[model samples]
Target: DAGITQSPRYKITETGRQVTLMCHQTWSHSYMFWYRQDLGHGLRLIYYSAAADITDKGEVPDGYVVSRSKTENFPLTLESATRSQTSVYFCASGAGSLTDTQYFGPGTRLTVL
Candidate 1:
């Protein structure tokens, strides 16, 4: 089973452009998360969802948007992508609650030029 996975393992785009990254899980996990990996910030949360149709902004959601319309999918969009948005984006899933152990995807490396 595909526990949790991400698409377009790698992406490249120009500044001001827009890009969408996809994440999927087969377990119908109750919680899903979006995060970006940077040099200093490390892995910082961008957004998250408690369940289908329920979403919330995380520590860093300024240049990104996310939606979870179904239990097994969560996608993130970089609206008007910026150079600083260049980072390895990761999608994670947790079975029970926010504090539960989360499994991470392989990650999508996005480059902005």
Candidate 2:
């Protein structure tokens, strides 16, 4: 598991419930990111953490939360998920440097009904 992996590759749930998608990377990269992709819209960053306890909100952080207390795991939680939140989630990681390239995990497709 030297690369990143996402759990529950597919999910379907009703609105107003909370759902958490797990992300794990064995590379021990210092930077982790969460993003959501929707039809007609490219990936939008939800949150990112440079290191343990160093997290920041990205462009679309509303309704979503992330934590990175460990270097190899970053989980994204949708608090009170809504129909509007249905989208494909992706997890990515990179070294803690600007010159590093990010590696993406297989996406998780979530549908809210």
Candidate 3:
């Protein structure tokens, strides 16, 4: 098991609904990232934060939002959930550029019907 884990491993919501996926890591890292895996899109970065209170949008951040308040906690929110946004979401944390390794959480499978 990883030190990092995502809450509500599985979730089902209706279109236009709002959903939030929680992520927590035991190993405190300066950087945390959120990614979504889709059929054709593969895995795309949604958001990332370099440190507490410093976050930036990633490849796909139009329909989603993320916040990093503390070093070990990062949460992602879907402002207006949609069917097309259905995908497996992953949360990861990494040390500085030295390790070049990211510990990933299990992943949250969300279905928007």
Predictions in order: lDDT: 0.94, 0.91, 0.90
Best TM-score goes to which candidate? 1
Model 1: per-residue Cα lDDT at residue 65: 83
Per-residue lDDT, model 1, residue 1, is 75
- Alpha-carbon shift of residue 54 in model 2 (angstroms): 1.0
| Model 2 RMSD, rounded to 1 decimal | 1.2
Model 1: per-residue lDDT, tens digit, 1-112?
7689899999999999989999999998899999999998889999999999899999999988888888999999999999989899999999988988999999999999
RMSD of 1: 0.8
Q: Once model 2 is optimally superposed onto the true structure by TM-score, how far is the C-alpha of residue 104 displaced, in angstroms?
A: 0.2
TM of each candidate vs. truth: 0.96, 0.95, 0.93
Instruction: Give the lDDT of residue 58 in candidate 1.
Output: 92
Against the hidden true structure, what lDDT does model 2 obtain? Answer: 0.91
lDDT of 2 at 56: 93
Query: Candidate 2, TM-score vs. the true structure?
Result: 0.95
> Which residue segments of model 2 deviate by more than 4 Å?
none
